[model samples]
Target: MKTLIFKTASGYLLPLLVLFSVFILLRGHYLPGGGFVGGLIASIAFVIHSFANGLEETKHLIKMHPGFLMPVGLLLAILAGASPLFIGETFMTGLWFENPVPVIGMVGSALFFDLGVYLVVIGVTLTIIFTISETL
Candidate 1:
């Protein structure tokens, strides 16, 4: 894993990759970008960081196991999708609520889906990192 970190001039690109991944994940519902794309982007960022910094340093950067996050994301996505059913709506139906505190419009299933995507991305990205790091 230490071998994966490659500190060099190219290392600066890591932050940008993470930012882009978030963008992809956020825009998933409105655009083509989604959890899968975002996850790949994030994974690439970390992988690049690992290459630039070294696997050992990269390991320190991660606070938790990325693989475990995958299931959490899946659960969130399922819950989001199924929530409509419990509410007497079709699967994946759109739901919204107005936040009385701020009096803001709150959207439902879309956000839930995004959450699921976020989890999936995190899990997949970690899995990739672990696999590649171990091989190296």
Candidate 2:
């Protein structure tokens, strides 16, 4: 596993996967894709790395426990939902913000919600995968 190919290919592949995952996540709020898809994509990337390396190495690479991810994700989702309350709107009500942001047009509260879902999905998926992989 100390070969150059493993190191080099993983080095290149990880960033590319992250970029693609983010692209899917951002576009998903509006298009067919969304948080679930994006999170799965990101999880796959890490899973690939785990297969290439070892579980302990992958854990070290991630620098965080899988159990910790779920809570953070849940918090994000809750925050996204609660955001509307600050503006005198009902919870989970979609609020639009007409901002001319490049690449990501019309950033809105829905996007925040999507992002929250994205984090939650990634966290849950990774937690499951890693936990099961430990048994295998």
| Candidate 2 backbone collisions, by pair | 28-33
**Per-residue alpha-carbon lDDT of candidate 1 for residues 1-136, written as tens digits (9 for 90 to 100):** 2242335543667888888888787777667987778878888877777677767667788767788888898999998888889978999898776652242135557767887887788788778767877896
Candidate 2 Cα RMSD (Å): 2.2
Candidate 1 error regions (>4 Å) = 1-11, 98-106
Q: Which one is best on lDDT?
A: 2
Each prediction's total of clashing residue pairs, residues at least 3 apart in sequence or on different chains, is: 16, 1
TM-score of 1: 0.79
Superposition TM-score, candidate 2 onto the true structure:
0.85
Candidate 2 off by > 4 Å: 1-8
Residue 21 accuracy (lDDT) in model 2: 89
Each prediction's RMSD over C-alphas, in Å, is 3.9, 2.2
Residue 28 Cα positional deviation in candidate 1, in Å, after optimal superposition: 1.6
